[model samples]
Target: MISISETSTQRLRALAAATAAALLLAGCGTAEDDAPTDTDVSASPSAISLPVTPVTIELVDPGAEPRSSLTYEPAGEQSVVLTTSSTVSQQIDDQAAQDFSTPEITLPLTAQAPESDAGGEIRLRIGTPTSADQRLTEALAVAEGSEAGLTVTDTGAVTALSISPNADAEDAARAAIEQALNQAVYRSISFPSEDVGVGAVWTTEQQVVSGLTLNQTTTATLRERDGDRLTIDLRIDQTPESATLELPDDAGQLAIDTYTMSGSGTLEFDLGRSLPVSGEVTVAGEQQYSDPEGTTVLRQDISDTLRWSTP
Candidate 1:
C-alpha cells in the first residue's frame, strides 16, 4: 500500500488521476430532527448511554490491515481500458459478467481530542491498501498519503479536505478522491445530541455532489442495549439521481440515468466508554450508464464491515 500521508505531493496527484472511473457512493441510516430527551424518554431492558458528557469518539488505529472493499460493475462492455500504473488489466473480463472490487482499504481513523460537547473537528489520516489485486491496489492508491487529508466534523460530515490531488492531478482523480473521501466519512459515527435509550431513532441527509446529483440519506435506531454493549439497527437509502458524463474530445459521453444505492446493517456502541465497538452494513444498488455507442449498466451488492480496536 502507498503511504499517501507520507507520499510526495507529485505522486499522490498523479495517482488520483489514474483511478477516476469508479465513484459510486452511499450513506448510513438517519436520525430524526428531534431525538428523545433523557428527562422524558422510554427506557429499554439494555443500558446504553449517549455522549451527554464531554467524551471522545474515535477510531483506534489497527496497524496496516485490510479493512474495507469497494466494487464496481459496469452494465455493458467496458469500451475504455482501465490501466493501472502497470499494464491494461482485464480483471473484469471485457464487458462480461464481472464485478471489479478494489483492494481492501483501511480508513486511517486517527484523530486528536474531539470535544463531543463542542463538536470539534477530527483529522483522518489515510494509509495504504492491503488488497492482493494489483489493479485495485493501484486504483485505490491514495488512501494513505501525507498529501491527502479528510477533515470531518465530530458529527461525521466531511466539512473540508485536501483529498483532491494538487493542481497536477487529473480531473477524474480529483473528482474520485472527493467521492471516496465523502463515502469514507461515514467511518466516523455521529452521536445523538442528547442522551437517549434504545428505540430512539434519528435521520441524516446530506448532499454529496454539486447540483444535488449524488444525494444520500440514512436512518439509525438504537435497537438492543446491555450495559456497555449496545446494538443499533441501521437502514440507509440513497436518492435516485442521474446525470450524463461529458466525454473528452467528443469520444462519446456516458450518462447515468438510473442510480440509487442503499445499505442495511447494525452498529454496536460502548456507551460506558463513549466509543464505537463494531458495525457492519450490507449495501446493494444498480445504475444505468448510457453513451453514444450503447448503454452501460452497473450493479453492486456487497457487504462492508468494521470493528474498532481497543485503545
Candidate 2:
C-alpha cells in the first residue's frame, strides 16, 4: 500500500483548489468609472499583504513634439463590464497530457473614488460572474457580489489591494478569486512621469509573487492620443527569481528546469476614468518541474479582455 504524508495531502488539496479557481476565473486588467461623487469613507487597510516592490518606469521615447503630461483623475461613480477566457494543459511523468478550456466569462463592476483631492484611492464592487457554459456558470455562482478595493497613484501604480469574497463562498472559490484579482492588479500599467505624445515609449519593471516569485517587465508604447483618451500597446515578460521553489506544508522542493512567459496586448485608456477604457492581453508559457518522484510539465495559454460602456 502507498501512503502519503499529511503535509503532502494538504499541499495537494491546495493545488487542487487553485486549479478549480483558475478554471472559472482566468484574465487580467481593470474596468472604467462614471462621474465624480464625494466618498466619505477612509481607505480600508490592505487585506492581502505581500512584500512591496518598487516599480520603476523609464521613458524610452517622448514621441513626436507637442508632448503633454498624462495623469489619472478620479471620476465619480461608473459602471463597466469585463470578459475573460483561458485554456490550460498539463502532463505528469509518463501520463497523457490533458487540455481544458473555459467558456467566456462576463463580470460587471462599479467603481467609486474617494473624496480626497489627491484621488489616490478607488473602491470597486464586482457583481456575479456569468458564462454561457452551464458548468462554469454553476461554479461561479458562489462568488456573487464580491468586492475589491485598491490604492493606486496618479500614474496608475497599484500599491495596496484587498478582496472580500461572498459570505457563503467556499475556500476554493475564494482562492481562485484572489488569484485572479492579484493578476489583474499586477498586470495593470504604470505611466511615466514625463510628458509624452503619440508614439511615446516606456518600460516598467517590478517583482510579483503569485504561485511563484517572478521578475515582471512591461514595455508600453503610446499608439494614439485624442485629448484625454489614449491607446497604448503593451508587451510583458516574466522569469523566475530563483531555480528552486519550496512547496507549501513542506511537501518537498522542486527544481525549476525551464520557465518562460510572455504576452502582448493593447489598452484604451482615459485620463478622466479610474480604469482602462478597454483592453485585451494574451499570454502563453511552458514550465517544467522536477522532483524525486519524476518530472511534471505545465503549459498554460490565457487571454483576457476588459470593456467599458456607460451605465
Candidate 3:
C-alpha cells in the first residue's frame, strides 16, 4: 500500500520531468506576444462547432495504496505519448486510469475475464493548433470565471479539465468519462501548430495489448464568421465493441458500436483585444462500458451546460 503523499510525490516528479522537457523543447521557439492575428469569421450568433479528436484519460488514485501514474513521453515528430501504469504493479492499469474521472463501481465479478497481453501506445502528434484549440486559447487569454459559460475552477496545475458529473451512479461515471474524452480532445488542441495561423492540429492512433482492437476518429469545426461571434464544435466516435472489440460489422450496432462524445460552445473574443474571453459549453453524449456481466454495456445519455475559464 502506498500513501497518498507518496503517490502525489511520484506524480509530481513525473509531471515535473515531463513539463521540464516540454518547456525545454518549447524554448526553441519564440513566444507570440504581439496583438493576435484576429481573423474574425461570421458564424451563427447562437451556434458553436465541435471539433473531432480523441481525448485520453489516465486515472491516478492517491490513497493508502497508490493506483497508477500518468506518464508523458516525447515521441518523434514533436509529439507526445501518454500511458498509465499501476503503482501496485508494472501492468498498465487500465481500469484505474480509465475510471479515475468517474465514480467507483463495486459490482461483484461473477466471471473472470481473460487477461490480455496486447500492448500498444496512443500518440497525439502536436504539430499545429486546431480551430477549437486556438479558439480556446483566445478564450483563455481573456477568460473570467464569471463569464466562462461553464463552471470551472483553476487548481493551479499543468492541466485544467471540466467535470460534468451525473447524479446517477452510472450516469455520473459516464459524465466523468465524457469529460476525460473531451480533455483528450483538448490535449490535441493544446499543441501549437505552425501550419495554421491560429489553430491546432489533432491526430490519434490506438494501440492494444491483446484481444482488443481499437480505432477512433475525431473532428472539430471552428467558425467565427457567421454573425459576430465564435463557435467551436467537436465530435469523436469509436468503432463498436465486437468479439474482439473491433468496429461492429453492422452499422445499426454502430450507434452503440463506438463510444461517441461531443461538446460545443459559443465564445466571445471581442474584449478590448486583450484578456477576458467568455463562453459556455452545452454538450451531451452516451458512455459505453462493460457491465458486471462482462457483456458490452451502455449507460444513459449525459449532458450539461456550464461556465468555463482559463488563465
TM-score for each candidate, following the candidate numbering: 0.50, 0.78, 0.26
lDDT of 1 by residue, 1-311 (tens): 22213232233222222212222332211122112223211222111121111223222221122222111111111111111111112111124333334333333333333344434333333344233456544554643342333334434444443332333334433333443443444433455444455566666665443222345566776676565466767676766344664433233344555555666777665533323445655555554444444433323333333334332
**Residue 128's lDDT in candidate 1:** 47
In angstroms, give how far residue 31 of model 3 lies from its true place. Answer: 38
lDDT of 3 by residue, 157-204 (tens): 122222222222233233223332333333232211212212222333
Q: Which candidate leads the pack in lDDT? A: 2
Candidate 2 lDDT over 201-249, as tens digits, reads: 9999987654456788899999999998989998988778888665554
Residue 159, candidate 2: alpha-carbon lDDT: 80
By lDDT, is 1 or 3 better?
Answer: 1
Residue 87 Cα positional deviation in candidate 2, in Å, after optimal superposition:
2.1
Local distance difference test, per candidate?
Answer: 0.38, 0.63, 0.25
Measured by TM-score, the strongest candidate is 2
Model 1: CA > 4 A from native = 1-23, 26-99, 107-109, 115-119, 125-129, 134-158, 162-181, 210-212, 225-230, 242-257, 270-275, 291-311
Model 2 residue pairs with clashes: 34-78, 35-76, 36-76
